[model samples]
Target chain A: MADSVDTGRPAPRTSTHSLVVEAIENRILSGELGVGDMLPPERQLAEQLGVSRAAAREAIRVLESHGVLESHVGSGARAGTFITSMPTAALSRFLKLHVSLNNFDLDEVVQTRLILEVESAAMAARRQDPEILQRMGEELAAMDDTDLDREDFGDADTRFHVALARGGGNRLFADMTQAIRESLRAPLLDGYRAHEDWSGLRETLQHQHRELLAAVAAGDAERASQLAAEHIHTSYQVLPADSGGSRRQGNRTAAGGV
Target chain B: MADSVDTGRPAPRTSTHSLVVEAIENRILSGELGVGDMLPPERQLAEQLGVSRAAAREAIRVLESHGVLESHVGSGARAGTFITSMPTAALSRFLKLHVSLNNFDLDEVVQTRLILEVESAAMAARRQDPEILQRMGEELAAMDDTDLDREDFGDADTRFHVALARGGGNRLFADMTQAIRESLRAPLLDGYRAHEDWSGLRETLQHQHRELLAAVAAGDAERASQLAAEHIHTSYQVLPADSGGSRRQGNRTAAGGV
Candidate 1:
């Protein structure tokens, strides 16, 4: 494994730990498992899969980290390993780390997210599920709050877009959008803080949000999509090109002595 | 933690274990740790973080599963854990599991991917890197192979689009497209195998792939984007709507007896 790591490849997938991981994955992939469903005990899972208890536990940890499974210690319903659906947590974790390492550039992140957001707004207009629309409205109000600061506004802004994604009734789009948006939350906040005219910028953003919501409410797919694209494009264009706009601002200082 | 897990909430995230996780994550996000950078010994990390060794080890496992860290044993450069960047493996693994569990409907998957593939084609046209163009040509040739099976063609088709995505020089888009395409490889193969006019369909697909490559090579971003969108839309529409088209075909069988 170390040799493989040295050579920059993954370890062989046939290890006992990997087999346990695969066994669980096979069940999920086969539709034999799903969210809200409890797994057999760790002992039973190991026994069924012919692996050691330690291997099973580690496999559970891995799956849990993947957001495909969750485990609880006490003996009861919901107190055992169970399938879960938490794409946002896992995807955000993976993407944020990779983004921080400069494996992905800021321009690409902003552009890719813009594409998703545009499609999401279009879909939301066509679908217009009342529940999701309500959430979007609430997030809009939060963003419009007079007391909100830069960070709070950033957070609310992210939620508002995520709500729009959900309004499209596509979990995959919503989840991916959530991950991408959340991963950029800090950097975007830094961009906001660094701006010379945040007050003006915030007003423009709030106005766009309101108009976009109106488009969705009116079931105007094309207008909603156009608004979403322009909203993101303006935000990016207005933000300073330096500061936290790029990941390498702190790159040279990280010796990683820890 | 068990109580929280039982209640269907994440652990508070401030526990000793989570503290270790956060400390490591902070280092990575701060750019203090990055791809190829090694962490301290487990015992040393535990001491510095003022956490138990078990907590630190679990934290490492969690991060490792998140695809942000790799660990190995033996005495050398790669023996201990090192930060790593592997977006495809992590995202594909996560997407495949979620898709199989029907957390994302097939239509949304197809539509979301269409949105991305279209953007990727446009970007690839504008960039036209020699290496990526060569890879696209190679995949196109592989698809043109007369002896290729449905599965082989499916794999080749995925690679061609992924190559186009890479040509755009956006690791974020390319990586996301890779994850989505790879996750659908088996189902798309299933769709291809179930088709009635395999020969005719293959020819049309090969033609589209060649034209797409040509448009990309000619730097026609608009044509490339349009071609990409039509290609995916046609593929999904022409395929039988009943045959492995919906995720629910195998849904009932998955009592997840495991």
Candidate 2:
């Protein structure tokens, strides 16, 4: 509930630049300003928001980093800030840091992934899109290589999951599923690099992924979903214990490892 | 796979400020930076990143908006930038704009929600945390008011779902579930207002919510999951057709509405 936004407006408490940021974000969310719509010049925006030009510029830069807006430096109409649709990177950037710092625990990230990947696998099986299947097969094959290092294996592993998500034929689901998986990439890679039995763990993951992919390829929706869940459970179990432990121990998670 | 973050470093193509921003983000993602780690002084950071003071300041401002860092503006030891964990709003802000701009269609959004809420509801039934249940009950009761308007109902509806996610005992699940639900608030509210039979839609939603709540309360995990999925389907079915249709004509979808 704390994470939920109150639709009701609250009094501004931050700097003028943040107020300016909020002003633009509100417009985009309310659909008053849409993709490709240019914002006024820095001076005009400053005057409109009653903030300094520096504040306005700062606000624009902030939005740019979020991928919510794009800027072109020029003197003409083509050079102002424009509302831009943020890609999945915008979502993943925050998630990666959250996971890295244990703002989101390892267990919960895996849990969320299980929730998404299971349903996504089921949908992919139901759809059985050949192109997506081909993409997934390629990544799965790369992981099948016996000599693959941890870093290369990690890349292929991530792509394989993301490709499976795309087979579900839902862009938003695919993007979000990819975001969650990507957030765990660095940590999981670290886990693989540090684990006592990296080869054994890698071999186990390959087996699980191959079975899951086969289920998906055969259009066994139920089997695909169940295998997807099982794969997630196995992956979570393989993560290093220290990475799963919290610096801020609380009742949020019990003794459950996953 | 497009939404995925490539572990390989990309050549920086943006401004000096963006390079500075990237330097900070790279550190966070690599675990070199963590929560409460103080950033270097403005002048020092500018020199370290090989950027002007103004560029360094701009980069800091951008990171501040991402909620990845916080700053205290003073001339003392305790007054410097420090890494901070971003709340769910950082994720939701981009999602809201994406949905509002039709970057993510209603079908994908609802589908993603169905995946989350179903599993989340099942977990809620399994956990049955009393505090979370009571919070959910409060929201459910709030929505049960006969005189409640769409806005009030929407707020309660959101809180109820978020509470359900929390009851699952996964903080990431709760935060992400809240973020996804909040992203649709503005457009969904508009849909409610514009529809001819607002009261009828409201009543149907209330009934569906109550049934879902009852199943969760009964600690019937399978039944709760089923009911959660059904509720999502019903809610999606009730949305306006135009709202679900894409402004972009593409091969991504073939005439699916929710």
Candidate 3:
């Protein structure tokens, strides 16, 4: 497998580690390698690619960080680097960090979420999956706990949206939805803590959740989509601005309602 | 800054490097560390966090892979790891690998793209930005070239959609659109190459692009959205399947249409 890599002409200025990384990535992209496939050991890979073991090790570390490769210790069948399928957590972490760095504006993030969740809710309603409905119901019940604090309620809220996304029966959409919701977790929690009237807002939010669930249960796709959008818009109206003006200000100026 | 880490009780099995990674991630998420803020030197960070220098270095590598940090070498004001804002290529790379791994089904990816681009088209129409429109026009002209090969046309096609996305005036939405389009580039190119009647399909695609651009130029949000959806649906119909049945087959089985 290593002999297939073209090493006749090394590109000038490119690091040996990067070349190895690109060679491995090309194999994966070409469908030559896949999940659960173990890669050559550092020494073997270094020899095969005509690079140093340190370069091979660095490449492994980079791939491991991307959640594309998993390293196992010990001398056993499984004690090697294997291609892994772990997109959800990795995507969430990537989006969360970029969001924290302010690479994406808060309003744009919220708007993107509105687009995804609204579509997800509609699809979920159309599918009407009982298992997903049950999971969402459980989250709704948890959110209704009288003694639940802001942080706990926020977590349950995230779960509810995640469940709805999964119910749509589209893994890609669900993963993106999950990542966006999780990325906003910290800021949303801050907003919840700063609310002037937590009880009133909580009741309103709970009521909306119940209605949205009912829409899904009844297989009312249009209503579910509309309700999801309105819920998000209303929720954003109350959340405080993280940096500049509140999202409510931007929403009013933006064209096309929800 | 390192003194703020909660290192009172480290999990027995968790690696020290992971703990360091989490500490820095927490500081960023909490807004204590913004973009452009340089992290302490590896030695100092290790000492402050009560971890080995090797662990700190590993943590830095992980963050750098995620596009959250950049390392500058040599001795100068810029010679250190600083938080950076560069999530586009990183995101595209992640999505491409996962798509290649089949973690996300092709139909699901297409569906997600539809949800995003349809809204993007409408938003672009509503915004009607002159510069974005000019960019889209240039891409359209490039695609009109009779001598263009499959590869060049595909690249221009990707650029056209990317321009429409940027015209939507939502950075988050545009970035997601760009990443999704780029991730599907190879498969789409393959499908383009395998077609028995390239010119016929090319004409149809170019005509559809013209109509979509006209809708956007006219500021007809509904028309632009409908055109965008129809264009994607039509284009996907002609593309060959990577595995299993074609996307057209899956679309026929799936409920609801854009």
Candidate 4:
């Protein structure tokens, strides 16, 4: 197992800034430091840690990028760096890049999505909360309206699935599910745009959403799961084949295509 | 849906350094910049990007932390910064921190693992790759042997599961599954150490592993999935009551508790 901290510097490796960042990160992870807690002044931290100011500043810069730290502009107390809770955006960015880099293929992405959504749908069925369910209903309603565009439908569709994931009562899983689903928004929309029969596809999706909502509301876990899996498979079957391919091969951020 | 890039501001609302970094990151993600490509020299980049050398340097440092860019030390052809790929370690670190910060709760973590591992276990069974199977078999045998320490058994046990995750065709899922499982390594070992009947627990796990392997060998997807789920659930049941809860209260980093 990897150690909590890389304690063994077997050889001259990483860099001074990296090591400094790790040290501070360990403290945050260990709860010695916490959200809202201010870090020592750069010079003080450097002196205490026996590192140069440049190293300390670089470490701070790293943490700042990760959203683990925030800097306030002022003199005294508000001036220093403070620990901050990273929002889901950080996770989204990381996962997006990872996927774009071919860290996971389209098949893998689809399969992973299937597994998460199936379980999430099942859980949502078992513990259907009215508030969240209502939100989902709104998404379905939005899709059904005559003036709704494909992009709008796509965004609503994402929110609908995300609501189901959140209903599953797992934060990490929900965030991941949200990330994956959101990442596919552009590509899925591109496929939707390319569809010759938009009304037919929209009708099918609407029917599926209604069925899914009914299952969840009725607390039918098995039916919810089955519908969810079917919904995903049927929808993807209609997606433009080229849109599902790696968008990273060209000079477009996956987001642009989405 | 959020736009690909925030081009509203000529520069970002915050530090110029951060804006430069975000722009570069956006470029990289968009595939405008590919691996092995060299970045412009600091002075030229700063001037072209309408930022200072200090800001350019800071941007480089931030990207370096994420393993997106690397800088050379010597005054040679390779002395400039270049885009590079990061190993799964960077992803793991991001996930671990997010987990620690309660970006996702216990239920989320468990469900995410369930999604990844169940699929992975089923695939591993179907593939029946000799090397992975052999590694898993070693762990199973180690668990069965009475003289093995709790720590050793736990380590082996993690390996068995990790091997199964890697067997899945999806590297991203495997990397994520391995990272989440590894994060729990310390706590699982602590639970093993605290067990009143270590032999009994080991016996149970061994039986589960064998059954899981048998399912995989026979290409019984349903059985492999069921076995994997039960294995995780039973192991969680045996863990100390405080195992998951202890994380939020404190003890973020491993202090060698087990």
Candidate 5:
């Protein structure tokens, strides 16, 4: 069993800046600090943490990059670092690079997506939110344009999935769904551009989207879930076999091809 | 549909450091940079990107935090920033802060967990690796200790779940499952400590864990998924109502109580 209580005490092995990072994280996790709350100035933080100003600055930079904190420079109480919430962008960026780096295999990613999106589609169907439904339809319509480039079509495709995720009425699920879809955007577009049977593949995807949307609109949770799973499976199958093979081989070769 | 093709060019609205960050991210995503590839020196990078040294340094800090790069200091060929792959820790840290800050509600988190773990449990059941099964049994046995404290039991509980996740044989799913479980470690322990009838709650959890493990061991995917879902629901039901309510209220009050 992994240790449950971290105690928030920096171990001797941890770096100085990382210790500062953990100290701040402990505060945030323990609720001593919170969103919209400004952090102390670099000097004060350094003094309080008994670390150099450079270490504190590095820690702040790390937190800022994670979307947990935002720093504003100027001369005022509001100008220092303030806790912020922007997980979606940060999560997307993290997942994208990891996925690109082959830290998570393609099959694993696709399976995870299937698990999340199938449930999300079912939940969205149960909710039957008209606004989200409309957004999905609009994305479908945008994809129907025959003259649209592969990149544009991929954007519409991503938006359609994102809309379905949002329709589930769960921000966490929606954010994750969005992140995964966005992370795969480039590779999916590459798949589209590489396919010899572009028109046929596009028709297949469009038809699946229409059917999936209809299931959601009709509030058939089971049908929506099944369709979502099938749609994802079919979509991924169209990608070149080498696209998601490995970090060194697949991504490197695919990058050159693009 | 949002723009899909991020042409590596920096937009006028983007900050100098952010532009540098994106430029590097583009290379990583495009597979131009792979693991173990060293980045140019800060001065040279800044010169090449037409940005200040400070900008390059800040960008490196951001990328390093994202687990895309690692920096080493000293006067040697090996001492430089190199692309790295360590998404597990970085991803966990991001999710923990976001969950702590109430960006994702407890209900949403539990629901997401149910979706992931249920699928994960089913996958594990299908795989049925004896080694993983044995590890899970050991964790359950550890939890069987009547004298175990709330913290120790919590750690055992987390390990049991982690074992189940690993059994699924999907790195992405396992990593996410671990992150979510670890993120809620403190809150779960607090819940355990605060419960009026600790013994009764422990008995219920142990029973559920046994049943779930049996389902997995028998390779009954459907039953395993159902049991996993039920276990999660019953477990979270024991947590206080405000355990996951909001950042300012739920966590702050709970922190004080703990």
Candidate 6:
């Protein structure tokens, strides 16, 4: 019988550390190595894979960073490394970086933010709790402060949207909503800084925030969704058109270099 | 500095590796670790932190797995580790695994998918090029083949939706759409096999697909978005209402284990 056609490509002429790292990731993703499964001893695994112990050790470290594996300090068999399962924060950080890389343009990001926040606002309107609404109120109050700097106002604005998303009562939606919104913080601040009418802009934003919070508080799903979408689109429209915010940032930089 | 006050805790036994990982992540999130910056050398970093070389090496490996670090190997001073960015796929994988760990329930997944796909379909209707529309048509055709197995049909179904997202002309929206849809592949297939009326269900799905494509082809954004949302909701409604189709599989396994 033919040898399973070697599903992996031949390792490039790189360090052995790279090869070992890839092998371990393959095993984890393919489900051959699952959560809570103890890895074989380091020396034995190194021997089986025909690599050095240093390479195997490096592979362990890589997986540990991704939260794919955990190790305890001990001797004997119990000291072996085991697979771990972590929260989506690891993934969220990865996405945040990708967004910063300008793989997607500003228009695209704005459009996406429109979709997510509109949906989140609608859901929040329909199923919001008192605590979340109170949080939105606080953020609005902070934005209304006349002494607030552009940076502080921008931070408050971000918090307000994040609160609205959390009020939607869906963790996945809330997390993605927060991630995408937070990803825009830098650019939004840049826009705010470039504005000569910072006070006027802050006043306008605060007005919108109060209206949106009231709509959501009253469970006005249709109104809330429309307002959220309009707010996002309008903000993007108002930003300085000359500066290419997307391209000026880092480019490419995919997680795996793809 | 009063020796940092220790809070009267048990000697503050945190590992040096863990501390390094957090510090690095903090820098990245705060925009200090921009792409193309070189990380401190392993030996130098170890001494700077007052930690062993092994700890520093481990921290480096972890960041590498998250796609935050890349390395160059050379005989001279040119060799060093570099900070890098990751791709959306990495985030998607993290989201998928997070969902698997029950961080978000099945209903949340379904609802999030509905919100994303509907907006994506609407965008695709307005912006998709002829080539993208053609690829979507091909995916639909693949699903129409009666001889296709459940796996291939599910894959084709996913591709059809993914193609629509890609055509939406918004990279962030498309990435989010693709991630949610791709994550649903396994559970959706499992749900498909659980139904007794497989042939009838398949026919219904095919009809919906045809209707959706027709709507897209006609450039009816409103109709396409509405149809896509209904399509997603209808599928979930068909699945066993208990804990979704996967729950049944899980219960059976639990009973067998007992």
Off by over 4 Å in 4: A1-13, A75-80, A244-258, B1-13, B41-44, B70-72, B75-80, B138-152, B244-258
RMSD of each: 5.5, 4.7, 6.7, 6.6, 6.4, 8.0
- Candidate 2 lDDT over B1-258, as tens digits, reads 111123322223378888898898888766678777899999999999889998999999978766677776666665788787665766777677677677777667776777778888988998778898889889988887878888888889999999998888777777777878888776577778887888888888888888888888889999999988877776666466666334433343431234
TM-score of chain B of each: 0.86, 0.85, 0.87, 0.77, 0.83, 0.73
As for candidate 6, its clashing pairs are A254-B86, A254-B87, A255-B86, A255-B87
DockQ order of candidates, top first:
1, 2, 5, 3, 4, 6
Candidate 1 has a TM-score of 0.90
- In model 2, which runs have C-alpha deviations exceeding 4 angstroms? A1-14, A30-33, A36-50, A72-82, A244-258, B1-14, B30-33, B37-44, B47-50, B72-82, B244-258
Steric clash pairs (candidate 5): none
Compose the digit string of candidate 3's lDDT tens values, residues A124-147: 999999999999999999999979
Runs with alpha carbons beyond 4 Å of true place in candidate 6: A1-88, A238-258, B1-88, B238-258
Residue ranges of candidate 5 with Cα displaced over 4 Å: A1-13, A47-50, A73-80, A245-258, B1-13, B38-56, B71-82, B245-258
Prediction 5 global C-alpha lDDT: 0.80
Question: In candidate 1, how many Å is residue B116 off?
Answer: 0.7
Candidate 1 C-alpha error for residue A33, in Å:
2.1
What is the C-alpha local distance difference test score of candidate 3?
A: 0.80
Question: Evaluated with lDDT, which candidate comes out highest?
Answer: 5
**Tens digit of per-residue lDDT, candidate 3, span B1-258:** 111113321113266777898999988887788876899999999999999886787788778778787776667776787877667777888888888777776677778889889999999999899998999999999999989999999899989998999898777777787888888887787788888989998999999999999999999999999999999998777555544222122332342352
The candidate scoring highest on DockQ is 1
lDDT of 1 by residue, A2-119 (tens): 6665566655566577788888898788767777789889899899988888778778777877888876666655577778766678778887877777776667777777888888
DockQ of each: 0.47, 0.44, 0.38, 0.32, 0.41, 0.27
- Better candidate number, 1 or 6, judged by TM-score: 1
lDDT of 4 by residue, A1-258 (tens): 022113321112378887898898788656577666788899999999899998888888878767677766667545667776654555666666555555555556667778788888888887888987999999888888869888888888889988998886665666777778766665677788888888998899889999999999999999999999899887776555555344445322221011
Q: Which ten residues in a row have the lowest lDDT in candidate 4 chain A?
A: A1-10
Q: Return the TM-score for candidate 2, rounded to 2 decimals.
A: 0.85
lDDT per residue (tens digit) for residues A1-258 in model 2: 111123322213378888998898877765678776889889999999999998898898888777777766656556667776666777777777677667777777777777678888988998888998899889888888889999899889889999998888778777777778788776677788888888889888999988988998899999999999888887766566666334534343531234
| DockQ of candidate 5 against the true complex | 0.41
Question: B33-60 in candidate 5: lDDT tens per residue?
Answer: 8877899999999999999987788788
DockQ of 6: 0.27
What is candidate 5's lDDT per residue for A8-54, written digit by digit as tens?
Answer: 21113266887898899989888778887989899999999999987
